[model samples]
Target: MVSRQNIIRVADFIDSTTRSWRTELILNTFSKDDAQKILQIPLTHIPHDGFLV
Candidate 1:
C-alpha cells in the first residue's frame, strides 16, 4: 500500500517539476490474488499519461 506520506512526497515532486503539469492521484485496494496478477503483467500493458506507484 502507498502510504499517505509517500503520496505527499510524490505530489510534492510533481509540483516541483512544473506548475503547468496536470496531476491526478488514485488509490485502490485489491485482493492479494488480484494484486499478484497485476504485478505479473508488464507495465507496457498499462496505459496512462503518468505512472503507477
Candidate 2:
C-alpha cells in the first residue's frame, strides 16, 4: 500500500532531518552501508530503472 503520498512524505522527512550538520554526518557515514545493501541485491530482483521495492 505504498502510495505516491507516502513516497513524498518520506522524501520530505529525509530533507527536513538531514539539514543539520550532525544528521548530515550520520547520513553520509551510513550511505555506504545503504549502497552495500542495495548493491548486494540479485540482478533478477532489480528493476529495469534500478528501483527496489
Candidate 3:
C-alpha cells in the first residue's frame, strides 16, 4: 500500500498540473499500478525499450 504521504504527494502534484500537463506528470511520476488511478492519456504509457517486465 502506498503511504499517506505518497498519496498526498501524488494528489498535490496532480492538483498542481493543469489538464494539459497531467499526462506528462503522471508518466514521469508513476509506475503502471500507480498509474492506474491517474491515467489521463493513452499515449503516455511508454513502458520502455529494454525495461524489465
Candidate 4:
C-alpha cells in the first residue's frame, strides 16, 4: 500500500528534475481510489552532446 506522503514525494522529485532540465512534466490521475491511474511524463527533446551521459 503506497502512502500519500510517498506519492507526493515522488511527484515532487519528478517535477524538480524536469524543471532542472528545462522540460515539462505532465501528471494525470484518473481516479482518487487506491487503484488510481497515475502517469508522470516528461516531454522529449533532442539531447545535446553528453546530455545522455
Q: Find the candidate with the highest lDDT and give its number.
A: 3
Model 4, 1-53: lDDT tens digits are 33344555433323343433212222222243321223334434433333232
TM-score of each: 0.30, 0.27, 0.31, 0.17
> What C-alpha lDDT, on a 0 to 100 scale, does residue 13 get in candidate 4?
29
lDDT of 3 by residue, 1-53 (tens): 33435654433443333323355556566787776665744333333233333
Q: Give the per-residue lDDT of model 2 (tens digit) for 1-53.
A: 33334444322323233332233433444477874554344333222332456
Could you tell which candidate, 3 or 4, scores higher by TM-score? Answer: 3
Question: Where does candidate 3 stray beyond 4 Å?
Answer: 1-21, 40-53
Off by over 4 Å in 1: 1-28, 45-53
> What is the per-residue lDDT of model 1 for residues 11-43, given as tens digits with 9 covering 90 to 100?
332333343212232214345666555445433
| Model 2 weakest lDDT span, ten residues long | 12-21
- Candidate number achieving the greatest TM-score relative to the actual structure: 3
* Candidate 4: C-alpha lDDT: 0.33
Model 2 spans with C-alpha error above 4 angstroms: 1-30, 45-53
Candidate 4 stretches with Cα past 4 Å from truth are: 9-53
RMSD per model, one decimal: 10.9, 11.2, 12.2, 10.8
Q: Rank the candidates by TM-score, best first.
A: 3, 1, 2, 4
Question: How high is the CA lDDT of each candidate model?
Answer: 0.39, 0.38, 0.47, 0.33
